[model samples]
Target: MEPCSSPPLLSLGTATTSLSPHPKPIPTPTNTRLAAYYWFLVPGDVFNDYASLADEINEWWWFYDGVLINTSPMGGTLIARGYINGNIPHTGFPLVNLYAHFTY
Candidate 1:
Protein backbone atom coordinates (compact mmCIF):
# COMPACT_ATOMS: atom_id res chain seq x y z
CA MET A 1 0.00 0.00 0.00
CA GLU A 2 1.04 3.60 -0.60
CA PRO A 3 2.12 5.87 2.24
CA CYS A 4 -0.71 8.34 1.75
CA SER A 5 -3.36 5.65 1.45
CA SER A 6 -3.95 5.14 5.15
CA PRO A 7 -5.13 8.65 5.79
CA PRO A 8 -2.33 10.56 7.58
CA LEU A 9 -1.51 7.82 10.04
CA LEU A 10 1.53 5.69 9.16
CA SER A 11 4.89 4.67 10.48
CA LEU A 12 7.17 7.63 10.95
CA GLY A 13 10.13 7.60 8.60
CA THR A 14 13.60 8.81 9.58
CA ALA A 15 14.07 12.56 9.57
CA THR A 16 16.85 15.08 10.20
CA THR A 17 16.08 17.28 13.19
CA SER A 18 18.14 18.90 15.90
CA LEU A 19 18.26 17.19 19.27
CA SER A 20 18.45 19.54 22.20
CA PRO A 21 18.85 18.83 25.91
CA HIS A 22 15.37 20.21 26.57
CA PRO A 23 11.83 19.19 25.81
CA LYS A 24 10.29 20.85 22.76
CA PRO A 25 6.62 21.37 21.95
CA ILE A 26 4.85 19.15 19.43
CA PRO A 27 4.75 20.50 15.88
CA THR A 28 1.42 21.29 14.28
CA PRO A 29 0.08 22.50 10.92
CA THR A 30 0.71 26.07 12.05
CA ASN A 31 3.19 27.94 14.24
CA THR A 32 5.92 25.31 14.06
CA ARG A 33 7.74 24.94 10.75
CA LEU A 34 8.30 21.22 11.01
CA ALA A 35 6.93 19.08 8.20
CA ALA A 36 6.18 15.32 8.30
CA TYR A 37 5.77 14.72 4.58
CA TYR A 38 6.23 10.96 4.16
CA TRP A 39 4.41 8.20 6.04
CA PHE A 40 5.52 4.57 5.60
CA LEU A 41 4.60 1.11 6.83
CA VAL A 42 6.72 -1.54 8.53
CA PRO A 43 6.11 -4.13 5.83
CA GLY A 44 4.11 -7.10 7.23
CA ASP A 45 1.91 -6.75 10.32
CA VAL A 46 4.87 -7.07 12.61
CA PHE A 47 3.17 -5.32 15.51
CA ASN A 48 -0.49 -5.36 14.63
CA ASP A 49 -1.41 -5.79 18.26
CA TYR A 50 0.97 -3.04 19.32
CA ALA A 51 -1.48 -0.23 18.85
CA SER A 52 -0.37 1.27 22.13
CA LEU A 53 3.05 1.69 20.58
CA ALA A 54 1.98 4.87 18.84
CA ASP A 55 0.99 6.44 22.14
CA GLU A 56 4.47 5.96 23.46
CA ILE A 57 6.01 7.46 20.36
CA ASN A 58 3.61 10.38 20.32
CA GLU A 59 4.45 11.14 23.92
CA TRP A 60 8.15 11.14 23.27
CA TRP A 61 8.40 12.20 19.67
CA TRP A 62 10.88 14.98 20.39
CA PHE A 63 12.91 12.86 22.73
CA TYR A 64 15.89 10.83 21.65
CA ASP A 65 16.94 8.31 24.28
CA GLY A 66 15.28 10.57 26.89
CA VAL A 67 16.74 13.85 25.65
CA LEU A 68 14.28 16.31 24.18
CA ILE A 69 15.02 17.90 20.79
CA ASN A 70 14.13 21.46 19.82
CA THR A 71 11.90 21.08 16.74
CA SER A 72 11.00 24.69 16.05
CA PRO A 73 11.58 26.29 12.68
CA MET A 74 14.89 24.43 12.26
CA GLY A 75 14.32 24.03 8.54
CA GLY A 76 14.02 20.74 6.69
CA THR A 77 11.17 18.34 7.53
CA LEU A 78 10.06 16.52 10.70
CA ILE A 79 8.99 13.14 9.45
CA ALA A 80 7.45 10.73 11.96
CA ARG A 81 8.29 7.67 9.87
CA GLY A 82 8.46 5.03 12.54
CA TYR A 83 4.92 4.56 13.80
CA ILE A 84 3.25 3.98 10.46
CA ASN A 85 2.80 0.23 10.74
CA GLY A 86 1.00 0.36 14.07
CA ASN A 87 -1.14 3.38 13.28
CA ILE A 88 -4.20 1.48 12.16
CA PRO A 89 -4.26 -0.92 15.03
CA HIS A 90 -7.65 0.36 16.15
CA THR A 91 -10.52 1.51 14.00
CA GLY A 92 -12.12 5.01 14.22
CA PHE A 93 -9.33 6.32 16.38
CA PRO A 94 -7.04 6.67 13.39
CA LEU A 95 -3.86 8.69 13.73
CA VAL A 96 -3.54 11.46 11.23
CA ASN A 97 -0.12 12.48 10.01
CA LEU A 98 0.68 16.07 10.98
CA TYR A 99 2.40 17.67 8.00
CA ALA A 100 3.42 21.30 8.47
CA HIS A 101 4.04 23.22 5.25
CA PHE A 102 5.36 26.78 5.15
CA THR A 103 5.28 29.42 2.43
CA TYR A 104 7.13 32.57 3.15
Candidate 2:
Protein backbone atom coordinates (compact mmCIF):
# COMPACT_ATOMS: atom_id res chain seq x y z
CA MET A 1 0.00 0.00 0.00
CA GLU A 2 1.08 3.61 -0.51
CA PRO A 3 1.50 6.09 2.30
CA CYS A 4 -1.58 6.92 4.37
CA SER A 5 -1.42 10.53 3.17
CA SER A 6 -2.78 11.10 -0.31
CA PRO A 7 -4.06 13.90 -2.53
CA PRO A 8 -7.53 15.06 -1.63
CA LEU A 9 -10.49 13.41 -3.29
CA LEU A 10 -12.56 16.57 -3.31
CA SER A 11 -15.07 14.90 -5.57
CA LEU A 12 -16.42 13.04 -2.51
CA GLY A 13 -16.84 16.33 -0.61
CA THR A 14 -15.29 14.81 2.51
CA ALA A 15 -12.01 14.76 4.37
CA THR A 16 -10.49 11.32 5.04
CA THR A 17 -7.31 9.38 5.25
CA SER A 18 -6.59 6.26 3.25
CA LEU A 19 -6.52 4.50 6.61
CA SER A 20 -10.28 3.98 6.28
CA PRO A 21 -11.79 2.60 3.12
CA HIS A 22 -14.26 5.01 1.45
CA PRO A 23 -15.25 6.64 4.72
CA LYS A 24 -18.50 4.71 4.89
CA PRO A 25 -19.84 2.73 7.84
CA ILE A 26 -19.73 -1.03 7.82
CA PRO A 27 -22.64 -3.12 9.06
CA THR A 28 -20.42 -5.43 11.05
CA PRO A 29 -16.77 -6.03 11.60
CA THR A 30 -15.12 -9.35 10.76
CA ASN A 31 -15.08 -9.40 14.58
CA THR A 32 -16.98 -7.21 17.00
CA ARG A 33 -15.05 -4.15 18.09
CA LEU A 34 -16.08 -0.83 19.51
CA ALA A 35 -17.79 1.05 16.65
CA ALA A 36 -16.20 -1.44 14.23
CA TYR A 37 -13.37 1.00 13.61
CA TYR A 38 -11.09 0.85 10.58
CA TRP A 39 -8.35 -1.10 12.29
CA PHE A 40 -10.85 -3.68 13.49
CA LEU A 41 -11.47 -5.14 10.05
CA VAL A 42 -9.50 -8.29 9.52
CA PRO A 43 -6.31 -8.08 7.52
CA GLY A 44 -4.49 -10.80 5.58
CA ASP A 45 -5.77 -14.04 7.02
CA VAL A 46 -5.18 -17.30 5.20
CA PHE A 47 -8.81 -18.15 5.89
CA ASN A 48 -10.23 -15.28 3.86
CA ASP A 49 -11.40 -16.49 0.48
CA TYR A 50 -11.92 -14.48 -2.67
CA ALA A 51 -15.63 -15.21 -3.01
CA SER A 52 -16.40 -14.13 0.53
CA LEU A 53 -14.56 -10.84 0.23
CA ALA A 54 -15.93 -10.14 -3.22
CA ASP A 55 -19.49 -10.77 -2.13
CA GLU A 56 -19.10 -8.62 0.98
CA ILE A 57 -18.20 -5.45 -0.84
CA ASN A 58 -20.82 -2.80 -1.53
CA GLU A 59 -18.40 -0.78 -3.66
CA TRP A 60 -14.73 -0.32 -4.29
CA TRP A 61 -12.12 1.81 -6.00
CA TRP A 62 -9.35 0.64 -8.29
CA PHE A 63 -6.20 2.70 -7.97
CA TYR A 64 -3.27 2.58 -10.31
CA ASP A 65 -0.05 4.06 -9.00
CA GLY A 66 -1.95 5.59 -6.11
CA VAL A 67 -4.56 7.29 -8.31
CA LEU A 68 -8.14 6.07 -8.42
CA ILE A 69 -8.78 5.03 -12.01
CA ASN A 70 -12.06 3.21 -11.59
CA THR A 71 -14.89 2.74 -9.11
CA SER A 72 -17.76 0.50 -8.14
CA PRO A 73 -21.29 0.57 -9.59
CA MET A 74 -19.25 1.87 -12.47
CA GLY A 75 -15.96 0.27 -13.45
CA GLY A 76 -15.73 -2.01 -10.42
CA THR A 77 -16.80 -5.14 -12.27
CA LEU A 78 -14.37 -4.40 -15.04
CA ILE A 79 -11.57 -3.85 -12.57
CA ALA A 80 -12.24 -7.18 -10.90
CA ARG A 81 -12.43 -8.90 -14.27
CA GLY A 82 -9.17 -7.34 -15.31
CA TYR A 83 -7.53 -8.53 -12.14
CA ILE A 84 -8.86 -12.04 -12.59
CA ASN A 85 -7.59 -12.06 -16.16
CA GLY A 86 -4.17 -10.79 -15.12
CA ASN A 87 -4.80 -7.47 -16.80
CA ILE A 88 -4.44 -5.04 -13.89
CA PRO A 89 -1.34 -2.86 -14.18
CA HIS A 90 0.37 -3.45 -10.87
CA THR A 91 3.97 -2.30 -10.87
CA GLY A 92 6.67 -3.02 -8.30
CA PHE A 93 4.36 -3.66 -5.35
CA PRO A 94 1.44 -5.98 -5.97
CA LEU A 95 -0.80 -4.59 -3.24
CA VAL A 96 -2.98 -1.62 -4.11
CA ASN A 97 -4.98 0.50 -1.76
CA LEU A 98 -8.16 -1.03 -0.36
CA TYR A 99 -10.90 1.52 -1.09
CA ALA A 100 -13.98 -0.60 -0.66
CA HIS A 101 -17.42 0.06 0.82
CA PHE A 102 -19.14 -2.61 2.83
CA THR A 103 -22.78 -2.38 3.91
CA TYR A 104 -23.44 -0.57 7.16
Candidate 3:
Protein backbone atom coordinates (compact mmCIF):
# COMPACT_ATOMS: atom_id res chain seq x y z
CA MET A 1 0.00 0.00 0.00
CA GLU A 2 1.05 3.59 -0.57
CA PRO A 3 0.88 6.57 1.72
CA CYS A 4 -2.14 8.81 1.30
CA SER A 5 -1.74 11.60 -1.24
CA SER A 6 -3.97 13.88 0.78
CA PRO A 7 -5.51 14.27 4.18
CA PRO A 8 -8.80 12.58 4.89
CA LEU A 9 -11.95 14.69 5.02
CA LEU A 10 -13.43 14.81 8.52
CA SER A 11 -16.80 16.30 9.34
CA LEU A 12 -15.97 17.25 12.89
CA GLY A 13 -17.39 20.75 13.28
CA THR A 14 -17.61 24.19 11.66
CA ALA A 15 -16.90 27.85 12.27
CA THR A 16 -17.72 31.08 10.46
CA THR A 17 -15.65 34.18 9.80
CA SER A 18 -15.91 37.40 7.86
CA LEU A 19 -13.39 39.02 5.57
CA SER A 20 -13.92 42.55 6.90
CA PRO A 21 -13.50 43.76 10.46
CA HIS A 22 -16.76 45.62 10.81
CA PRO A 23 -19.11 43.17 9.10
CA LYS A 24 -20.73 40.36 11.07
CA PRO A 25 -19.41 36.87 10.55
CA ILE A 26 -21.18 35.38 7.57
CA PRO A 27 -22.39 31.80 7.73
CA THR A 28 -20.51 30.82 4.63
CA PRO A 29 -20.77 27.15 3.72
CA THR A 30 -21.38 24.92 6.72
CA ASN A 31 -21.09 21.13 7.01
CA THR A 32 -18.22 21.02 4.54
CA ARG A 33 -15.15 18.87 5.11
CA LEU A 34 -12.00 20.57 3.90
CA ALA A 35 -8.75 18.68 3.51
CA ALA A 36 -5.51 20.47 2.70
CA TYR A 37 -2.37 18.69 1.57
CA TYR A 38 0.86 20.50 0.80
CA TRP A 39 4.50 20.59 1.52
CA PHE A 40 5.79 23.01 4.12
CA LEU A 41 9.23 24.51 3.80
CA VAL A 42 10.68 25.21 7.19
CA PRO A 43 13.91 26.48 8.67
CA GLY A 44 16.34 24.07 10.29
CA ASP A 45 15.23 24.94 13.81
CA VAL A 46 11.55 24.49 13.06
CA PHE A 47 12.17 21.18 11.35
CA ASN A 48 14.13 19.98 14.34
CA ASP A 49 11.31 21.02 16.64
CA TYR A 50 8.74 19.03 14.69
CA ALA A 51 11.00 15.99 14.55
CA SER A 52 11.49 16.11 18.27
CA LEU A 53 7.75 16.41 18.91
CA ALA A 54 7.01 13.39 16.75
CA ASP A 55 9.60 11.36 18.58
CA GLU A 56 8.25 12.37 21.95
CA ILE A 57 4.66 11.48 21.02
CA ASN A 58 5.68 8.10 19.67
CA GLU A 59 7.65 7.36 22.78
CA TRP A 60 5.00 8.46 25.24
CA TRP A 61 2.00 6.95 23.50
CA TRP A 62 1.57 3.33 24.56
CA PHE A 63 -0.96 2.57 21.84
CA TYR A 64 1.57 2.86 19.02
CA ASP A 65 3.38 -0.16 17.56
CA GLY A 66 5.88 -0.73 14.75
CA VAL A 67 6.09 2.97 14.03
CA LEU A 68 8.28 3.86 11.03
CA ILE A 69 10.46 6.95 10.91
CA ASN A 70 12.71 7.83 7.99
CA THR A 71 13.42 10.31 5.24
CA SER A 72 12.34 10.56 1.66
CA PRO A 73 14.51 9.04 -1.06
CA MET A 74 15.45 12.50 -2.34
CA GLY A 75 16.92 13.45 1.03
CA GLY A 76 16.44 16.63 3.09
CA THR A 77 12.97 15.41 4.03
CA LEU A 78 11.55 13.56 7.03
CA ILE A 79 8.69 11.10 7.18
CA ALA A 80 7.17 9.59 10.27
CA ARG A 81 4.32 7.16 9.76
CA GLY A 82 2.47 4.67 11.91
CA TYR A 83 -0.80 2.88 12.53
CA ILE A 84 -3.02 1.74 15.37
CA ASN A 85 -4.81 -1.58 15.46
CA GLY A 86 -7.30 -2.70 18.07
CA ASN A 87 -10.95 -2.63 18.97
CA ILE A 88 -12.98 0.44 19.67
CA PRO A 89 -13.58 1.17 23.33
CA HIS A 90 -17.02 -0.45 23.48
CA THR A 91 -17.34 -1.85 20.00
CA GLY A 92 -16.02 -5.27 19.06
CA PHE A 93 -15.26 -4.41 15.46
CA PRO A 94 -11.62 -4.62 14.49
CA LEU A 95 -9.93 -1.34 13.72
CA VAL A 96 -7.18 -1.49 11.13
CA ASN A 97 -5.02 0.75 8.99
CA LEU A 98 -5.82 3.80 11.14
CA TYR A 99 -2.64 5.62 10.21
CA ALA A 100 -0.95 8.87 11.07
CA HIS A 101 1.64 10.90 9.16
CA PHE A 102 4.14 13.60 10.04
CA THR A 103 6.26 14.95 7.24
CA TYR A 104 8.38 17.99 6.57
Candidate 4:
Protein backbone atom coordinates (compact mmCIF):
# COMPACT_ATOMS: atom_id res chain seq x y z
CA MET A 1 0.00 0.00 0.00
CA GLU A 2 1.11 3.60 -0.74
CA PRO A 3 0.58 6.67 1.45
CA CYS A 4 -1.44 9.59 0.10
CA SER A 5 0.28 12.94 -0.50
CA SER A 6 -1.08 16.34 0.52
CA PRO A 7 -1.96 19.00 -2.01
CA PRO A 8 -0.51 22.51 -1.95
CA LEU A 9 -2.57 25.53 -0.94
CA LEU A 10 -2.55 29.05 -2.32
CA SER A 11 -3.30 32.47 -0.86
CA LEU A 12 -3.65 36.05 -2.06
CA GLY A 13 -3.47 39.53 -0.51
CA THR A 14 -3.91 43.15 -1.60
CA ALA A 15 -2.96 46.62 -0.39
CA THR A 16 -3.49 50.26 -1.40
CA THR A 17 -2.03 53.69 -0.70
CA SER A 18 -2.84 57.36 -1.40
CA LEU A 19 -0.64 60.27 -2.55
CA SER A 20 -1.56 63.98 -2.59
CA PRO A 21 0.81 66.73 -3.75
CA HIS A 22 0.72 70.33 -2.57
CA PRO A 23 -2.06 72.44 -4.08
CA LYS A 24 -1.05 75.33 -6.26
CA PRO A 25 -1.90 78.85 -5.14
CA ILE A 26 -5.42 79.73 -6.28
CA PRO A 27 -7.82 82.60 -5.71
CA THR A 28 -9.78 82.09 -2.52
CA PRO A 29 -13.52 81.85 -2.94
CA THR A 30 -15.76 84.13 -0.93
CA ASN A 31 -19.19 82.54 -0.87
CA THR A 32 -21.10 81.63 2.28
CA ARG A 33 -24.60 81.36 0.86
CA LEU A 34 -23.99 77.64 0.31
CA ALA A 35 -21.99 74.94 1.99
CA ALA A 36 -18.74 73.85 0.36
CA TYR A 37 -16.80 70.56 0.36
CA TYR A 38 -14.56 68.64 -1.98
CA TRP A 39 -13.84 65.03 -2.75
CA PHE A 40 -10.95 63.69 -4.80
CA LEU A 41 -11.64 60.30 -6.32
CA VAL A 42 -8.69 58.56 -7.89
CA PRO A 43 -8.93 55.06 -9.34
CA GLY A 44 -5.94 52.77 -9.44
CA ASP A 45 -5.99 49.19 -10.63
CA VAL A 46 -3.73 46.29 -9.68
CA PHE A 47 -3.14 43.14 -11.71
CA ASN A 48 -0.83 40.61 -10.13
CA ASP A 49 -0.86 37.00 -9.08
CA TYR A 50 0.19 35.60 -5.70
CA ALA A 51 2.12 32.48 -4.99
CA SER A 52 1.65 29.65 -2.52
CA LEU A 53 2.53 30.33 1.10
CA ALA A 54 6.16 29.58 1.82
CA ASP A 55 8.22 32.73 2.21
CA GLU A 56 6.77 36.20 2.74
CA ILE A 57 7.16 38.45 -0.29
CA ASN A 58 6.71 42.20 -0.70
CA GLU A 59 7.19 44.39 -3.75
CA TRP A 60 6.11 47.79 -5.07
CA TRP A 61 4.87 48.76 -8.53
CA TRP A 62 3.90 51.87 -10.41
CA PHE A 63 0.28 53.02 -10.30
CA TYR A 64 -1.60 56.27 -10.72
CA ASP A 65 -4.76 58.13 -9.63
CA GLY A 66 -6.49 61.48 -10.24
CA VAL A 67 -8.14 64.17 -8.13
CA LEU A 68 -11.72 65.20 -8.89
CA ILE A 69 -13.76 67.67 -6.86
CA ASN A 70 -15.26 71.15 -6.72
CA THR A 71 -13.59 74.25 -5.34
CA SER A 72 -14.52 75.46 -1.89
CA PRO A 73 -16.38 78.39 -3.41
CA MET A 74 -18.11 76.02 -5.80
CA GLY A 75 -20.06 74.55 -2.90
CA GLY A 76 -17.48 71.83 -2.49
CA THR A 77 -18.91 69.80 -5.33
CA LEU A 78 -17.27 67.56 -7.83
CA ILE A 79 -16.48 69.28 -11.10
CA ALA A 80 -13.89 68.44 -13.75
CA ARG A 81 -11.64 65.46 -13.04
CA GLY A 82 -8.36 64.15 -14.41
CA TYR A 83 -6.35 60.94 -14.34
CA ILE A 84 -2.84 59.48 -14.45
CA ASN A 85 -1.57 56.34 -16.13
CA GLY A 86 1.52 54.22 -16.70
CA ASN A 87 2.21 56.43 -19.69
CA ILE A 88 3.20 59.09 -17.15
CA PRO A 89 6.50 57.65 -16.15
CA HIS A 90 7.47 58.50 -12.58
CA THR A 91 11.06 58.24 -11.40
CA GLY A 92 9.99 57.05 -7.97
CA PHE A 93 9.09 53.66 -6.59
CA PRO A 94 5.83 52.41 -5.05
CA LEU A 95 5.12 54.93 -2.27
CA VAL A 96 4.38 58.34 -3.76
CA ASN A 97 1.34 60.68 -3.86
CA LEU A 98 0.26 64.32 -4.34
CA TYR A 99 -2.81 66.47 -3.47
CA ALA A 100 -4.11 69.99 -4.15
CA HIS A 101 -6.63 71.95 -2.05
CA PHE A 102 -7.78 75.45 -1.04
CA THR A 103 -10.65 77.06 0.89
CA TYR A 104 -12.28 80.43 1.50
Candidate 5:
Protein backbone atom coordinates (compact mmCIF):
# COMPACT_ATOMS: atom_id res chain seq x y z
CA MET A 1 0.00 0.00 0.00
CA GLU A 2 1.12 3.55 -0.71
CA PRO A 3 2.28 5.61 2.23
CA CYS A 4 -0.65 7.58 3.58
CA SER A 5 -0.15 11.18 4.62
CA SER A 6 -2.77 10.63 7.32
CA PRO A 7 -4.30 7.66 9.03
CA PRO A 8 -7.50 6.32 7.54
CA LEU A 9 -10.68 7.76 8.94
CA LEU A 10 -13.53 5.40 9.90
CA SER A 11 -16.97 6.80 9.18
CA LEU A 12 -19.74 5.34 11.35
CA GLY A 13 -22.54 7.38 9.79
CA THR A 14 -22.97 5.03 6.85
CA ALA A 15 -21.73 1.94 8.71
CA THR A 16 -25.03 1.17 10.41
CA THR A 17 -28.04 0.63 8.16
CA SER A 18 -31.74 0.95 9.04
CA LEU A 19 -32.77 -1.15 6.05
CA SER A 20 -31.25 -4.33 7.51
CA PRO A 21 -30.83 -5.63 11.02
CA HIS A 22 -27.45 -5.16 12.66
CA PRO A 23 -25.05 -8.07 12.72
CA LYS A 24 -24.18 -9.67 16.02
CA PRO A 25 -20.72 -8.83 17.25
CA ILE A 26 -18.15 -11.57 16.83
CA PRO A 27 -16.87 -13.06 20.04
CA THR A 28 -13.43 -11.82 20.97
CA PRO A 29 -10.80 -14.39 21.74
CA THR A 30 -9.70 -14.42 25.38
CA ASN A 31 -5.98 -14.60 24.69
CA THR A 32 -5.09 -11.63 22.50
CA ARG A 33 -1.32 -11.91 22.63
CA LEU A 34 0.75 -10.91 19.63
CA ALA A 35 1.10 -13.63 16.97
CA ALA A 36 2.92 -14.05 13.67
CA TYR A 37 -0.02 -15.59 11.76
CA TYR A 38 -2.91 -13.57 10.35
CA TRP A 39 -6.33 -14.65 9.06
CA PHE A 40 -8.56 -13.29 6.28
CA LEU A 41 -12.11 -14.05 5.21
CA VAL A 42 -12.12 -15.21 1.59
CA PRO A 43 -15.40 -15.77 -0.22
CA GLY A 44 -15.91 -19.34 -1.36
CA ASP A 45 -17.11 -18.42 -4.85
CA VAL A 46 -14.30 -15.99 -5.57
CA PHE A 47 -11.53 -18.53 -6.01
CA ASN A 48 -11.61 -21.83 -7.86
CA ASP A 49 -9.05 -23.28 -5.49
CA TYR A 50 -6.73 -22.42 -2.61
CA ALA A 51 -3.76 -22.10 -4.94
CA SER A 52 -5.51 -19.35 -6.87
CA LEU A 53 -6.20 -17.40 -3.71
CA ALA A 54 -2.63 -17.87 -2.54
CA ASP A 55 -1.36 -16.65 -5.90
CA GLU A 56 -3.51 -13.54 -5.76
CA ILE A 57 -2.29 -12.79 -2.26
CA ASN A 58 1.30 -13.34 -3.37
CA GLU A 59 0.83 -10.98 -6.32
CA TRP A 60 -0.06 -8.13 -3.98
CA TRP A 61 2.43 -9.08 -1.29
CA TRP A 62 3.77 -5.57 -1.00
CA PHE A 63 0.47 -4.32 0.34
CA TYR A 64 0.56 -6.65 3.29
CA ASP A 65 3.04 -6.31 6.14
CA GLY A 66 2.78 -10.02 6.97
CA VAL A 67 1.86 -13.34 5.39
CA LEU A 68 -1.71 -14.78 5.18
CA ILE A 69 -2.70 -18.41 5.60
CA ASN A 70 -5.89 -20.48 5.67
CA THR A 71 -5.18 -21.73 9.19
CA SER A 72 -7.69 -24.28 10.51
CA PRO A 73 -10.92 -22.40 9.76
CA MET A 74 -10.51 -21.00 6.24
CA GLY A 75 -11.47 -23.93 3.95
CA GLY A 76 -13.12 -22.08 1.00
CA THR A 77 -15.88 -20.32 2.92
CA LEU A 78 -17.90 -17.23 2.09
CA ILE A 79 -16.85 -15.53 5.32
CA ALA A 80 -13.61 -16.55 6.97
CA ARG A 81 -12.14 -14.70 9.91
CA GLY A 82 -8.43 -14.14 9.98
CA TYR A 83 -5.87 -12.75 12.37
CA ILE A 84 -3.00 -10.30 11.88
CA ASN A 85 -0.19 -8.86 13.88
CA GLY A 86 -1.11 -5.88 16.02
CA ASN A 87 1.80 -3.98 14.55
CA ILE A 88 0.64 -3.66 10.96
CA PRO A 89 1.71 -0.39 9.24
CA HIS A 90 4.33 -0.24 11.99
CA THR A 91 2.06 2.02 14.10
CA GLY A 92 3.55 5.48 13.97
CA PHE A 93 1.69 8.72 14.64
CA PRO A 94 -1.96 9.29 15.28
CA LEU A 95 -4.09 10.60 12.39
CA VAL A 96 -5.20 13.65 14.33
CA ASN A 97 -2.97 16.00 16.26
CA LEU A 98 -3.67 15.75 19.95
CA TYR A 99 -2.28 19.20 20.72
CA ALA A 100 -1.62 22.22 18.55
CA HIS A 101 1.54 24.30 18.81
CA PHE A 102 1.14 28.08 18.79
CA THR A 103 3.84 30.40 17.47
CA TYR A 104 4.77 33.45 19.47
Candidate 6:
Protein backbone atom coordinates (compact mmCIF):
# COMPACT_ATOMS: atom_id res chain seq x y z
CA MET A 1 0.00 0.00 0.00
CA GLU A 2 1.05 3.61 -0.52
CA PRO A 3 2.08 5.77 2.42
CA CYS A 4 -0.27 8.59 1.52
CA SER A 5 -3.28 6.28 1.61
CA SER A 6 -3.90 6.84 5.31
CA PRO A 7 -4.01 9.56 7.94
CA PRO A 8 -2.27 9.79 11.32
CA LEU A 9 -4.04 8.43 14.39
CA LEU A 10 -2.31 10.75 16.84
CA SER A 11 -0.97 14.27 16.38
CA LEU A 12 0.76 16.88 18.48
CA GLY A 13 1.65 20.53 17.83
CA THR A 14 3.85 23.08 19.54
CA ALA A 15 4.61 26.79 19.16
CA THR A 16 7.27 29.30 20.12
CA THR A 17 7.08 33.07 20.34
CA SER A 18 9.05 36.05 21.53
CA LEU A 19 7.94 37.62 24.80
CA SER A 20 9.20 41.20 24.86
CA PRO A 21 8.08 44.73 25.41
CA HIS A 22 5.09 45.59 23.18
CA PRO A 23 5.47 42.04 22.05
CA LYS A 24 3.61 40.88 19.00
CA PRO A 25 3.89 37.09 18.72
CA ILE A 26 5.37 35.87 15.47
CA PRO A 27 3.31 32.96 14.12
CA THR A 28 5.71 30.63 12.37
CA PRO A 29 4.35 27.89 10.18
CA THR A 30 7.82 26.43 10.06
CA ASN A 31 7.35 25.35 13.66
CA THR A 32 4.36 23.23 12.68
CA ARG A 33 4.21 19.70 11.19
CA LEU A 34 1.89 16.68 10.82
CA ALA A 35 2.18 12.87 10.79
CA ALA A 36 -0.02 9.73 10.74
CA TYR A 37 -0.04 5.94 10.26
CA TYR A 38 -1.99 2.65 10.51
CA TRP A 39 -1.41 -0.45 12.65
CA PHE A 40 -2.61 -4.06 12.80
CA LEU A 41 -1.99 -7.24 14.78
CA VAL A 42 -2.39 -10.57 13.09
CA PRO A 43 -2.33 -13.95 14.83
CA GLY A 44 1.07 -15.61 15.16
CA ASP A 45 -0.33 -18.77 13.58
CA VAL A 46 -1.50 -16.87 10.52
CA PHE A 47 1.90 -15.24 10.19
CA ASN A 48 3.66 -18.60 10.59
CA ASP A 49 1.48 -20.09 7.86
CA TYR A 50 2.99 -17.64 5.37
CA ALA A 51 6.67 -18.45 6.01
CA SER A 52 8.94 -18.70 8.99
CA LEU A 53 7.75 -19.18 12.55
CA ALA A 54 8.95 -17.07 15.40
CA ASP A 55 7.97 -16.69 19.03
CA GLU A 56 6.85 -13.11 18.44
CA ILE A 57 5.63 -11.21 15.36
CA ASN A 58 4.05 -7.86 14.60
CA GLU A 59 3.69 -5.07 12.01
CA TRP A 60 3.20 -1.32 12.20
CA TRP A 61 3.65 1.96 10.29
CA TRP A 62 4.66 5.57 10.78
CA PHE A 63 3.36 8.57 8.91
CA TYR A 64 4.68 11.98 8.09
CA ASP A 65 2.34 14.74 7.03
CA GLY A 66 -0.58 12.41 6.31
CA VAL A 67 1.69 10.00 4.45
CA LEU A 68 3.31 6.76 5.52
CA ILE A 69 7.04 7.39 5.37
CA ASN A 70 8.50 5.00 7.92
CA THR A 71 8.12 1.37 8.97
CA SER A 72 9.04 -1.16 11.61
CA PRO A 73 10.90 -4.04 10.07
CA MET A 74 10.31 -7.50 11.57
CA GLY A 75 13.21 -8.00 14.03
CA GLY A 76 12.60 -5.01 16.20
CA THR A 77 14.16 -2.06 14.37
CA LEU A 78 12.28 1.04 13.25
CA ILE A 79 13.37 3.80 10.87
CA ALA A 80 11.64 6.84 9.39
CA ARG A 81 12.67 9.96 7.49
CA GLY A 82 10.83 13.19 6.72
CA TYR A 83 11.18 16.93 6.30
CA ILE A 84 10.11 19.69 8.65
CA ASN A 85 10.15 23.47 8.25
CA GLY A 86 13.48 24.03 6.53
CA ASN A 87 13.00 27.72 7.17
CA ILE A 88 13.50 27.07 10.85
CA PRO A 89 17.20 26.42 11.51
CA HIS A 90 18.41 23.98 14.17
CA THR A 91 14.87 22.91 15.03
CA GLY A 92 14.47 19.14 15.54
CA PHE A 93 10.72 19.34 15.17
CA PRO A 94 10.42 17.09 12.11
CA LEU A 95 12.40 14.02 13.16
CA VAL A 96 10.52 10.83 14.17
CA ASN A 97 11.56 7.22 14.88
CA LEU A 98 11.39 4.58 17.64
CA TYR A 99 12.34 0.98 18.47
CA ALA A 100 11.12 -1.64 20.96
CA HIS A 101 10.99 -5.39 21.38
CA PHE A 102 7.83 -7.51 21.71
CA THR A 103 7.36 -9.46 24.93
CA TYR A 104 5.36 -12.64 25.00
Give the top-scoring candidate (lDDT).
Answer: 1
* Cα-based lDDT for every prediction: 0.38, 0.32, 0.33, 0.29, 0.35, 0.32
Model 6 lDDT per residue over 1-104, tens place: 65685667874545476546787777878744334321112221111112111111222222222222223445544432222323323245423333343433
lDDT of 4: 0.29
Comparing 3 with 6 on TM-score, the higher-scoring candidate is 6
- Residue lDDT tens for model 3, 6-93: 9669744565853565876678887565321121222221211222334534542433354442333332223322222222231332
Q: What are the clashing pairs of model 4?
A: 19-97, 19-98, 20-97, 20-98, 20-99, 21-98, 21-99, 37-76
Q: Report, for all candidates in order, the number of backbone clashes.
A: 11, 1, 0, 8, 4, 2
Residue runs of model 2 more than 4 Å from their true location after superposition: 1-30, 33-63, 69-71, 75-77, 81-104
Candidate 5, 68: how far from true, in Å?
3.1
Q: For model 1, give the 10-residue run with minimal summed lDDT.
A: 92-101
18-47 per-residue lDDT for model 5 (tens digits): 655877789999986543323332333122
- TM-scores, all candidates, are 0.18, 0.16, 0.14, 0.14, 0.17, 0.19
* True-vs-predicted CA distance for residue 74, candidate 4, Å: 22
Query: By the lDDT metric, which is better: model 2 or model 3?
Result: 3
